[model samples]
Target: MPLNIVLLDDEQHVIDLLSAYCESIDAADIVGRFSNPIQALNFINNHPVDLLISDINMPQVSGIELAQSLTRDVKVIFITAHSDYAVAAFELDVIDYIVKPVLLPRFLKAISKAQNAISASEPSTKELGNRELSNREQSARYIFVKDGGVKKRLVFDEILFLHAQGDYTEIRLKDKKLLLLGTLSSFQQLLPEGEFVRIHRSYIVNKSNVDSVDKDHLNIDGQDITIGKTYRQNIDEIF
Candidate 1:
């Protein structure tokens, strides 16, 4: 089925452009289009919205705020002229965030991503309690995080651990480190349950990547990370 999509932007022209792009590929059916985010939100509450394409820096309501207001299973793709809100979009688990003058190829790619995400989330005959299918699902897990101007796509298994650096979170892999502009709690939300545990206020380690665990710290990728008193329970439960 084609996705039920809503396009929202303060600029009528932007909404028209997005509508045209979606129309070109027949990627989605434009169920709604509104210059006011409030109207869009209200419409979404009463309708089936499979995908939401919105401009982030609107005057009525920021796209980030609009995405946060919804409490349903709708996929979101954010459009903005600025890259300032990418980290916030990341925390919200948005499918894709495009900066400014949305191109046809990029927009179609985002729609495709949303379609795949929706399809993957739905139960199928092959995924019904199939252990091998579960392992296949694990292989497809990944997220896009910005490292400076470049967006790095890291598979879940490649991540060794995560560390809090005040306002930024450090993503540690076996070979490199990337500091994303968000808190550890934000990154923690992106990880799968039971696979990653918060060992300290500043540290979260992947259980699969840990070399050893003692009373005070855990060794991961040859680096020692101290476990906090409060989070010892997390370690115990996971271990």
Candidate 2:
């Protein structure tokens, strides 16, 4: 299922950058982008979004306030420039708290948590919406892939990352890349949470495969991928 998303922030640059990054993630679609909180609230009244990505500091209303007012099962990921508000963000039971200059990789970390959380149970306002990895159990250990008209079965752990093209996802393994037709999200949902994270909108890197991360990028087996500003916190928490 595609996650319908709404993004609200006062900054146009932040909104545009994040909107593009969200589109790249291929996990969901940004149905609306509102610079005005009141307008955003009004839009919400008429439309139900599966996810919300909002800025904590706003003139008329705070992200926390909007979160409290939300009546739907939608999970929220708060984007803030200040680190001081991280505790407060979490206190509101936000799925994830991200510091400003959001990176796409970090954003996916939040999305993963939210997806896992919503998948576990029916979402409600009062329940903590954050995705937790402690309760996860291993399911499939291997995946069967078709390459050159031949079926190939490989262990899930053998995958290093999956890179997305226009209409296909290149599954990167330890030794080779397999071309498969589908959205990156389809493979993302199939992968185990603890082992993998979408480091870029187009790339899902294995946490174990990651060698290191710099200020603007992540290093995985000598490959560097830019991280979006909004996703930094969750990335820091995990990696």
Candidate 3:
């Protein structure tokens, strides 16, 4: 499942850049983006967030103080134009401290660290067929995908299956299909491992939507998908 992220920056342009970067990564979802530190804190208190990227030099409630006041263990990454606050920011044990303007490579490196920390701390997340690695994971029920130049929300339960088309993925819902600009392997990283299974070279089906299963074929939404030879054993174990 993707990480829920919050962005807090006093500047609107900075927030826009961060939002675009987060959307491009596909490994995270922007749960909230605020220009006011106080408002961002309120939302973070009431929501489940995995990471927070904040500008340290805000008018009210500096990012250092905000990180200290968090009610839960949410990882923080401080971004500031001035390097003078680095010492104080690190005292709060933040994930990373980034200096503005935040470049793409630096942001990606920090995100990778946050992902590692979250995966280690996650109490119940599935790792493909290894149920023993974790119990049932508490994951977001939906994901955001851009389609037709507009971002669309796709619920996990509403999705029937996924079809790989070279570098893009076709998400098959009950009524319509939404295409995403990503490979099937990359898209799988964002999916709840327990809920979806790779049954073929080009298809991944929602386990709860399965109607029938045989040695070579599995049925989902009344459509039969041939099970890949390598994945047949997984089907047996999962079913």
- When 1 and 3 are scored with lDDT, the better candidate is 3
Clashes of 3: 1
Residue 148 displacement (Å), model 1:
47
Local error of candidate 2 at residue 184 (angstroms): 22
lDDT of 1 by residue, 1-239 (tens): 77778888998889879877977765576667778898789756544567899989887788899999985677899999999889999899999999988888888788889989988886633223333433454666876666766778878888899988865788998788888765565466557666888889789888899999888888997898889999888777777
Q: How many backbone clashes does candidate 2 have?
A: 12
Best-performing candidate as measured by TM-score: 3
Model 2 worst lDDT run, 10 consecutive residues: 128-137
Regarding TM-score, does 1 or 3 come out ahead? 3
Runs in model 2 lying further than 4 Å from the true structure: 123-239
TM-score between candidate 1 and the true structure? 0.51
- Global local distance difference test of model 1: 0.79
Give candidate 2's TM-score: 0.51
Tens-place lDDT digits, model 3, residues 24-86: 997887766788899788757644567999998899899988998887678999999999999
User: Model 2: C-alpha RMSD to truth?
Assistant: 14.3
Per-prediction CA RMSD (Å)? 15.4, 14.3, 8.3
